[model samples]
Target chain A: MIGRVMDAGPGEPPIWVMRRRATAWTTPQRRYYQLVAALPPLRDFRRTRVLPMSQRRLEERLALLHPEDLADLRMAVSLVSWRRQPINRTTAEIAAMYEECMAATRNRALRSTVEFRMNVRTVMVALRLKRLGRGVPSGRWGVGNYTRTIESRWTDPEFGLAAVFPWIPEARVFLDQGDATGLESLLMGLLWTKLSQVADRHPFGFEQVFAFAFKWDILHRWLSYDAQKARRRFDKLVLEATSEYQDIFA
Target chain B: MESLVLTTGWMGIFSPLALGAIGSMIGVGRGGLAAAGAMLEVEAGYGRFVGVAAMPSSQTIYGIVVMLTLNRPVSVANSPGLFVLGVLTGVALLISALAQGTACAASISASKSKAEVFGISIAPAAVIEGFAVFVFVFALVLAGSIPR
Candidate 1:
């Protein structure tokens, strides 16, 4: 779909907007802007290889990196100081530490963006648990207004998720059918919507950068999980958006 | 003495033109670069970004107007008035144009990522343009009161 948009010539009523929406970023572009700026030389060096390689080839290389190799890769790309200390930690523990570090960031914009993203992830988890008919472990849900929002929607029959998320109907359909993959995709869509809202609301400053970077992550995850499905979704989105544009132009 | 007075008059007339040229150059240059960069990311709305970039060029037009309004012969007495008015107004236009360019650039960047707020995003740039307009109008009005 992106290829189709890229190949689209002039006289098109800008159907490329939706195609631009789902960009993939290997690193958190905004979060590490300063670091990247500091390592311009390294970036320029890597761009020679990274920009020319196919997405699959790049992923293949990334998949083969060891943790120490990952640390080296980070250093090579970002010039950030790294250590190869032999300490064992579970994914949850690492995530907790990351959340702690993100909370500790002095930049208020970065902090809020991280919080919002974590909150969305937590909401997805909570919804998944609800779908599985399992109870949410106490004190485990992440912070943000979304925690309350999801909890209210789950516990109160009258509180419709559709009030906050217009796409809730589609999500609910997936949930009803017990299509976990579909639900996950819908959850990711909801996340992009929320992030775009935040970015639009705070358009002038750091939030724009944060939104772009995070959306890139979503595109990356979607593409990696299922490239064919991602392509189909993109094609559908392009068709829908193009029709809307045509209506306006007409 | 006559030549010196005549030269001062020429300078007075040229001051706004020179200042305005520099102001508009920086203002338009900055805004144009930003708009171009933004266009790379955005799929459409080229007209909107380009329009915002043109905001800085108004300062130049204002400067030319002020020059025409100060069209009288330079004299010992009126030279001081022309100098003050032309220089101060030119400076105001310059600063306003530059600041407005920055504001426009920021707004363009915001809209590149989120296109829904394109209309409202340019509000800050418009506000900055308002300041430039205020200076332009004030200078034109005040130039009339200066002794010819």
Candidate 2:
């Protein structure tokens, strides 16, 4: 029904075609393999060479890609490889490396998403390190130029946690109170807010679909952790968002 | 009487209105469904979604204007002018409305969650409206040259 409504004039491209074109610019092959590795059932696999979303599917889908594409694919495989678990990389370092990998894809929306996630992750890790009274390794942040900004503000009392992510100040309160559940919920909410903005800014592109997929993944992980808790948290977040909307619209 | 109606160019008089109605109906219909879907996800801030959904309605207004501009008594002499301008302008409006509807739908869906994007998301629909305006202005300009 939605499809019929969206299909307009003869010249208008179909939604599926738009989706393909939008998503084609991103590292879809790498994303697909990452998803495969993230799946609990598949995580134990030493290699995903035999996975349906892996080599064969990638080759078939991206037959036009040059050798560089294959090289990128190999890099992704190495990153997701089970052996990499033994590496002593910090969360910030891992995130930075992943973001650097995504930057190579040359998709604007994907790059924005990676950069946004990197900033959020960097803040979270810095906060954790601060709470432990450890020094923040400013050099580890993966987002290129922003690393220096993050470093300077790493321990700046006034310009710390809440200042970095102005959109979700509640995150600071949750973190300060040691409310693990609230912090997790707030983090997801903040991420959703960014994803929603991306979807809005690029309505005709793959960002909307990516936002939905990212939300679904977060929700799924939350549910797996504790279904009842996750549901309650989600309902609360929606209520908060709705109330904020009402406040503005009223 | 039928022969008089033909010679008098009733087709020229009604052409814009008929095409306008068809175009607006399809355009609004497309955007309306999207607005409904959007409201399902976020009940608040519905006014903006509805506004975006109504973007295609401008085509109908353009159609009405063209109809009025071409409203001179249809004689064999002026009938061809009316027929060509009215029909072509109507077609342009029709195509523009249909395209605008799709953009409006996308806007509504996107703005449901991110209310801040309501303003920016409407840009694509507004761009589509520009094409409709070009048709409207050109039709009016061309109508001035038509003989009475």
Candidate 3:
């Protein structure tokens, strides 16, 4: 099934193609014994209120990575990071970004991590569109290998992917109930588990370093989700939205 | 054929020291890198990390001892026994040193963050050293019977 999708063309290559390419590249195994030893261990995001190592300290240790590996790591992180993308980016633009990032990433584990993240994001978007009563989106509506599977199985509750992604039903419940925090927490938890698996496979290698950095990002994001801070930001946005209208009425 | 057998005997005698030193160099390098890295994360207890890094060096000592025990005159009668025992001991010591180095590095990395686990974390490396000692002792006992 995946091969059929890849044979279609470069314009709409499946996610598995990225995996195949990543394997073919075979990034040289460089041990970062000193770097791995220097960095403090990271606990699961749910288990900690404070980050074991600060961003500055982590970056200091990451500086020991080979220059090419460091660049690849940064590129992979930027591609997956929600904050790094502008809100106004079109589907085509996002698709292009994915293509460029996947092409440039040499590490197999990092590429797989990025691929996993984008697939999750694509699924979430499909769910959101369904909730809004939008029809099966056409012409590059989202990024990842599952775009076609999602569209063809638009009516299926789990898009025929329940076996591969068991959390989809639970995510749908969160979406329907409008529990944004619950949904966000679920996504982070899943990513954290995935990063852990990746780290275990590539100990003392660049893949492990990337996994640590990605986990730190998740921890940082999770800790920053203060209700009071979010409420303040919400109010500020509301005030800005209505400020111009208020002047016109007066 | 006689000269070849003598040459083989000589090679076997020095194999333990040569192989053990090579293994020690790699093993120590791995542990030392980890120790140096750990130093960046911890303020005190620097001595323990350095100490653990030196754990693989014992293999070189074992190798030297085995070499001395097998250093008898090379002859057709005893050459085969010397060759087998010395080479076998060297290979065992080499493998043990390499494995122990990785264990030591892992222990150092773990203990640096949670200092309480320091004592227990080195247990694996200690177990590996015990295996090297087994080979060392048996090699000595066997060398005495090699018609020296």
Off by over 4 Å in 2: A1-96, A136-144, A158-163, A167-172, A228-250, B1-95, B103-144
Model 3's CAPRI class is: high
TM-score of each: 0.47, 0.45, 0.86
Best by DockQ: 3
Provide the clashing-pair count of each candidate structure.
0, 0, 0
Which of 1 and 2 is ahead in DockQ? 1
> What are the per-residue Cα lDDT tens digits for candidate 3 across B51-111?
9999999999999999998998899998888888888889999999999988899999999
For A139-188, candidate 1 gives per-residue lDDT tens digits of 43444445555655676432255565455567657767988678766666
Residue B25, candidate 3: alpha-carbon lDDT: 92
Off by over 4 Å in 1: A1-95, A104-109, A139-173, A201-206, A224-250, B1-26, B35-61, B64-138
- Candidate 3, residue B91: the lDDT equals 93
For candidate 2, the lDDT comes to 0.61
lDDT of 1 by residue, B26-139 (tens): 777766766776665556778887787788888888889989998897778787678788888778888888777767776666676677877898898788889878877888
- Stretches of candidate 3 off by over 4 Å are A1-26, A82-84, A227-250, B1-6, B76-80
| Candidate numbers sorted by TM-score from highest down | 3, 1, 2
Query: Cα miss at B51, model 1 (Å)?
Result: 12
Q: Per-residue CA lDDT of candidate 3, range A64-174, in tens?
A: 999999998888887676444777877666667677677777777787889899889888888998999988788667776787788899999899989888999999999
Task: Tell me, by lDDT, which candidate is best.
Answer: 3
Ranking by lDDT: 3, 2, 1
